[model samples]
Target: MVETADLTNHFLIAMPQLTDPNFSQTVTYICEHSREGALGIVINRPLDLRLREILAHMDLEADDAAVAELPVYLGGPVQTDRGFIVHPGTERWESTMEVTDGISVTSSRDILGAIARGRGPQRMLVALGYAGWASGQLEREIAENAWLSGPADPEILFELPHGARWSAAAARLGVDLTLISGQAGHG
Candidate 1:
């Protein structure tokens, strides 16, 4: 059986024919991997939300002078009300996951406060919610060819424009999304 550890720091690119309303054209970055299950955040789906808006709702001080000009992404279906920050390695915070060589996810409010104060990582993705799978579920799906896994690219996760993330991730595998077929096949 495949293990989550084997898929850590990887990208789960949706298959061409993926029709799930929540996952179509999604690019996910795996964070925690264990025998129990795995957790990741979708790096490409935006929900018309922003950091300032979220902070305002939370009643957390919004430092307009410092917040970067970036939009928050819908990480996944879980806990859409919460916040998660994926950023560069140079910045440090509590409850962080080094998703890749230079990319990390921080769940602590401290990092958010820093970002709001203009003292956070130079590059970052603020995600609300995350994608997850129970033990063996993700492996079973992979066996069914529901996804293609590849190493996560830091720049692709943090530097590219939000709308381009899906295509950019597929490009790493030499795939043109338009050529993909959502229908899964079985022999």
Candidate 2:
């Protein structure tokens, strides 16, 4: 067995050869990682739905005039109906998991209510579902060269355009993924 370091608060940039429709060209934030397993959210794949539509569906009142048109992201391929919020705030909400020193994930409706009322965290990314891996699964994938990971940068998460995140995440490792060949070579 190979020992693997926990990748919590890291970003997994999919290699071009990964080719998985759900993760291709994606940048996923590792929220939790351990010997038990790992879980993450894809930060770059926004869904067609808007925060207003979701608020309406949940019967939450929102100050429409105050609510910006926030696009919800497809966190991953798992639990497609569950919602998760990656935000940077000190206020703790129900079902919230502190991913790192300054970042957290909240899956409670109250946070959504706060957002609707324009009183939520200052920066947030609303997502549905998440990517998951069983024990040893992620490490195996890493060994297979399916991903390149680097320290998580909140700026990339909150400031970069969704379409540019994958490349930006890879750049953190000084890697230009575009230059990586799809075929593996043996020396």
Best by lDDT: 2
Residue pairs with backbone overlap in model 2: none
* Superposed Cα deviation of residue 20, candidate 2 (Å): 1.1
Q: What digit string (tens of lDDT, one per residue) describes model 1 on residues 83-158?
A: 8998878466887766666777899888877777767787778899999989898998888777888888888888
Per-model TM against the reference: 0.88, 0.95
- Go through the candidates in order and give the clash count of each: 2, 0
TM-score for predicted model 1 compared with the true structure:
0.88
lDDT of 1 at 36: 86
* Predictions in order: lDDT: 0.81, 0.90
Candidate 2 lDDT over 1-187, as tens digits, reads 4567889999999999998999999999999999989999999999998888889888986675545578899999999999999998658998899998799999999999988888888788989999999999999988989999889999999879998999888988899988999886898
RMSD of each: 2.6, 1.4
Clashing pairs in 1: 17-181, 17-182
Query: Lowest summed lDDT over 10 consecutive residues: which window, candidate 1?
Result: 60-69
In model 2, which range of ten residues has the least summed lDDT?
60-69
